[model samples]
Target: MDFTQAVEIAKHIYWIGMYLENDPFQCHPYFIENGDESILIDPGSMLEFEAVVRKVNTISSMKNIKYIILHHQDPDLAAAVPEMEKLIDRSDLLVITHSRMVPLVKHYLIRSDYYEIDKHGHQLVSGDLHLQFVTTPYCHSPGAFVTYEPFTKTLFSGDIFGGIEESWEFFAGKDYFEKAKPFHAEYMPSRDIFNYALTKIEKLELEMIAPQHGSIIQKEKIAGLIEKMKALECGLYIEKEYKDRLIHTIEELKEKDLALRASMQEIKEKEELLFQKAKMADMGEMIANIAHQWRQPLALNNTLISILKEKNQQEALRSTELAEKLQEMENNIQYMSKTIDDFMHFFHPKKEKNLFLISEVVRHTLEITDPMLKKAGVSLTFEISSEEAVEGYMNEYMQVVISILHNAKDTLLHRKTKDPDISLRLYENGKDVVLDIGDNAGGVQQENIHRIFDPYFTTKHKSLGTGLGLYISKMIIEKNMDGTLSISNTQDGALFRITLPRQSKTGKTDATQPDH
Candidate 1:
């Protein structure tokens, strides 16, 4: 069936493209009429060119078709160029496209005048209709663009927003974005590339979106589609590691489920003993940690006092020297105060759920731990690939980082291996934001790996071991925050990866904002 139709999208604009009965998405070709001039957009393949030309003839004369606007150089869009040239029957017919796409279009239709779009895109005026070409590079094509007609409040979007559906309606009812999500996720490169293009497109007062494939998006659904595009983690953003990480996480969760089931009865029976032991351990551990952290600063303060006393006794303290020493003391006091504040923050109970950038909190945790790591000759490195927010208790999250870090630091000291190094990396894997903390010391023993997170399981000396740290950290991450915390041995050392579901970058104001 020729089944060709002339569908009017705006006042002088028409979708005079032939419908593809066999093609699943039913690619649409549009026609824009401008007084004595006309524009043909994506005239379809050679097989459909004659049918499309015939369709256009029924509505507008072929002689008025002045230009063929190409958003990209895809064969589906430009395959008809050679055949359509025979149809145009005029040498003055100009092809509009980006310069990079010129060679491919020339290969199809030779000896044609080309109107190239610059980096900022091109503007083409057709009678009463003013068309603005907006560059949408990597919107599934290297040199793709969306034609925006301000007068009609319409956008001739080429594959930027579309979906595969059964029916071939000219305009989709309203569920366009929802239906189109899967297609975009598969086709579009990433949200980063779409962000700038979407910003430009959203600024326009658009009434309708006529895409080359699938149905059109119109009315209130325009904003919804734009918003969806803004946050979509598409093709380029999907990590190959995500699958393995997810599979491993599922196994860990199953094991934990079984362990928790078996341990709950024992935990309940020893509730009072558990509480007292936890309290004592936490108090002793942190207080000893405070001493470990404050040793250098305390020694430095004492040395400064001794120098000042000696200088005063000799009457050799100059004004400048006194100022310099006092500044040094002030800096030491500030650092000591900051260390206390960070540790305090770790212990402070979170008041409410809120969005927090875990990277910043992790950085602060590193700062509090840096002193001890340096003192123990353990070098620490932090790399944040992508920082995004997660909805949860920030203080609790900080404690988790601290707990894991302390474990790594202690292991490094315990092993007493030369040139100890800890590598902390924070990245996102499409579905979750992952924080992977690995070390250079020997990895976990295969035997002890399974029991690492168990409550009251200790492998350290009685003076230094609390075993409750990992248990408490696991509770804070999995039970309280809906995230996964797993540890495994790597080639160099042990790797502890915490996977948290990504949340809005600008966290919600459900809780009071913490003082900076």
Candidate 2:
């Protein structure tokens, strides 16, 4: 067990391996031999205490050990002190650690004389070897310390530069950087401790690094490694040259996303404008129908009034006939008042589904569109079916009718035919009510037929059309009112047809106007 060897530095200094070949605990102990006095640095584990004593026996010959320098109180480094004392008989000086580690070292090595080393530059002189203790706490443990020999410039770093691996090769393996990087990152207890220790070591110009569990380093690599550890300990978010490039990329993406959102918003606004235009066109057609409805009643009322004025002065005027004429005039006035009510309700904006007479909706829509049709010199015709009670949103249904009537009126006006005619037909088909509107004007263009219902797609002049009319009308009838609308270009003109369910899809019948 002669595990001691002296390197030719200044005096006889021996390096001893307590259990370098063992499985669990492997430590290297260095002995500084100066004439008669000796200093032992980290004397191996408790299990290898017998081997260390035997090895020390071969060199000293006297069973007396002078001093034991405990760098750290960790078991793997300084665990054998209690057992070593029993074998050797001498006035041994136990150079213990800092005040923080006194409790731990005292718990294990109870009878040994303790000497505390505090502060930065503390030295222990044992003949030729002057052991300068550098306080480097928090590198791996709270009571961690590194011993530097000023004579040989050899640093006994406890676990600061140590890494895990059983290989005897001192420098790390082929993938040294990769293996050593995580050993410090994952296993090191505190980053603050590592940083504080690194700052203290940077001031030292060391030539050799004899770590506790690993091989010795004696070049610029130790300093370089400590520099990197200091950088990591401070903070992991150090700014680099590539940070600007990443920021620029993020800004570009944000700008692109903003542009896309703006484009989508513009498209939505355009769609809404088109729907408004369609509704206006429908309103115009409704006005023409209203004019047609009021024409006969108003004219007849005027004629009756004129005749009554003339009869009032005539001798042939009789009381019986006067009553009949007066009663007839009263009926006409009541009819006109009813027409006004229908007109008011139809023009009102808020329109949702409800139970109402189909005939009233038709009459109100016609009243709103009649004036426009008459102004355009388009003749109106109506073939009303059975006067049945239907369930739906009144205004929405009227809007559909208005859109159809307006399209017919526009066709007739644009055609400028000698005989302009627009016809409205209503009938019951199975369980649904169907309305068909036709005109004697030229039909829509063949190529533009399919695009009639697409938003912003219109065949009329841009100033006269918003292109949303048909699209919105289609949405109102199909989605809101749960009805269907269709169009066809016939021989004479364009025909628009609409079908509505007798009962609402939701099965709830509303009898009032719906909120728009």
Candidate 3:
């Protein structure tokens, strides 16, 4: 429970989050020491980056951080990713997350390629390290998920079981569920969605629940906590609107006095009936999605079994080949049979395309980059000359902006510019929107300008730049958004311009864009 250093809660799991006294919402970032293939889960916000990094370094080197598991897109759990990736200094380190989270999480301008759990069969195997992911969409966010380590029987439950406690501890006591209920009531969408996530957790051979916030739940308290969460009145049922209305109605009935008791009884019965009907409808929809998600995996497992039987009958089955096939089939069957109930919810309505203001994207991007700029004593100026709307991937566009700003920041700092400055201007050009970002650092050399967008080309020290930033930025702007990314040198510095059509021509809804 000590927050002074990394606490090994399990054999290989370490609690590496920062401790802020009396803070209701404390973030917990965990580190798993799997030798060289160690993993960091929910690396936390920029505020805790230094503390988290120091704690991680105490037990293991940053270079050994092979995978960063992002539970969702919230800044409290993800904003430090860009900075952490730079410090980890491993080119092969990957950000493991759900495919539905790729769009938003990518806006942090992460350099490493993503190992999307949904696309990669919901499990990862590297060296002797094995991780299974569980989808728990809408337990908070649409792409919300959790990581389960079978060896330790520990579930990294993200915000699903997280609490807001004024007095915090590393491990949950019996009163943990009461502390966690308020968070679920405020953040979760409905009790049914929460119960769906609980059902998934119940299926796992869970010994502990290491969530992104609050205390970690031990095995002895796990079952009781799950049941309490299942029957808890949270989300829509206990939201301010519903609670206030119910209270007001009861108060009016009490004022009337004549049929107060009868009316109260009738209202309670009607409310229960309505809630049951709604819960049933929600459950049916969940069942349908589960069936849809299981179909492909089930079919594939069946095909593998058929192939195995035919090979055995023909007497052509090599022992090694048969063993591999059986293992593969077993994995498939396990996935299909015990799949996360809301796995298909990644395709929920939240992922659909919608119009977004260009100004808002710039604002959100600055909210992250501005702090870094100030810390480095670099001045930043921005202008929103137009209120243009772009019907493309807003988060992806934000990534493009962040990537450019990050490069500029590095360049200015590396050169030791006396009065470093970055300027941003967004305006409408014909039917397209144009964004111009310029920096006061010396302009790119003529020879390097042509090759700037080339992959693996860098004018930076080996550790400072991967040369992938400009390359991927071009790909995201040109290929994904049907836009153009071009650069020109002003009298004082280099200026990067991004031009995009106001409306999306491809109508692409896929959040998982190609990394290249």
Candidate 4:
């Protein structure tokens, strides 16, 4: 496991990472010794330049290192590129990387010409080695990519699959994802983008994963680790963390609400009270949403604990196995904790406006409501005709969408509608972005249509319905977000439409309104 000198991983592949003991963030640079056609993949920064060169010298001469693969433009993995060029000292020594990375990587002031993978069919044949470049865009970096060696079936994944390990191990163990999760949650942009990258990696005939950071993963653990990474929530897709921040903000808002209540004479104070009440009413729905999110993780935790108990009874579990299961259970418990945190923040009051895609709002809303809809035997479909963004409090926008879907789900379940269906459509119309949510649980009665958005108006039994939902939703769309929420009857169902002014180039919504 010692990485003091170059260690041969696969035939000609060597781990030349300058390992600093007890360092939490480890950068791994690999060397492929293919004689005079040698390649160095992600040589570490200037701090480790001398030591890394010393290790590379032991494997092959600097002049023979013909290619240096700069996976992405990150300084730790790429800053030493110019210095390396001085050492290799060859005019023909090409820098291998994706085309999308060329502009940024060039800022490193690297003089060697790039062997752009995208331009050259993503393949390279050096001596006996056949190398392939796999583009993994937006997996943390827009130009992010990985390298694959056909002969060794080994991947040099830049930042993907990397971890921040407090207790460093040369090879990934069974509890590897536990170390990987925190890093992914902090770095990866979103589950969708990361999963997209993972789909490509899954198709590869991979025998090993050598990341820029953390331990190398062998074939035995590749599938399980990839599966875990796919499920990881990170960056802007960290809804749970977002909600936690919202709740923390809400606690401060609640203190202001108390002051507003004491001065009820002001018209704005009355409006604030109504908004606060509506937010409080949403707490119940948020708790239900949390339950849906927690279902899988809680089930996994139970299964893990049960297996440990059963193994103990049979006296078949080794201490190593016990420790691994414990770590898994801890991870599951942490995930559930985040869900609970999200639930507690269901009533966040809008404080600031920002630009966000309507598509992202719809996606996050479905994440909260899909389980409940499926449990009631309701089928939901969402279609996007445009990717228009709006400037607003995104969380409030998400709340409005969630409220509409909840209302649809409840109505479908209440009326015992056979083969219940809900459809969501998002599109750009003129200067506005429109979202239509329709459900086939029958149309609302004509007499009740106008009164539906009235505060404290409900048709359902006292315990099941809170009249505040639609009222708050209407308020959020019209008053808070400068949009409109309208309801109309379709041939077989009720359709709710939300129309918000599109984000303009000036960081504000367009003043022009959509035709009703």
TM-score, candidate number 1: 0.46
Give the lDDT of residue 350 in candidate 4.
52
lDDT of 2 by residue, 1-516 (tens): 223443322244455664355342246666666545566778878665666666566666324466777777788777787677666555664655666677888877557677677742477776566777788765566777888887777788776676555545544444444434555665465466677777887778787777776555656577666666665622222234444665688899999999999999998797667666776665554455566767888899899888988888786678898899889988988877786776666667565457866666877666566667767887887777645556677777777777766766666666677789887777778888778888878777889888888877877667655667678878878877778888898898888888887753333322232111
334-413, model 4: which lDDT tens digit per residue? 97886665555445545799988888677766766766777778887887776777988888888888888888888988
Supply the TM-score for candidate 2: 0.41
Q: Give the number of the best model, judged by lDDT.
A: 4
- In the range 198-281, model 1's lDDT, one tens digit per residue, is 888888888998888888788678887788678887776666576467668899999999999889978766754654465466
Task: Return model 1's CA RMSD, one decimal.
Answer: 18.9
lDDT of the candidates, in the order given: 0.78, 0.68, 0.81, 0.85
lDDT of 3: 0.81
Q: Give candidate 4's error at residue 21 in angstroms.
A: 3.2
Worst 10 residues of 4 by lDDT: 507-516
Query: What would you estimate as the lDDT of candidate 4?
Result: 0.85
Q: State candidate 4's TM-score.
A: 0.47
Q: Pull out the clashing pairs in model 4.
A: none
Segments in model 4 whose C-alpha atoms lie over 4 Å from true places = 239-516
Between candidates 2 and 4, the one scoring higher on TM-score is 4
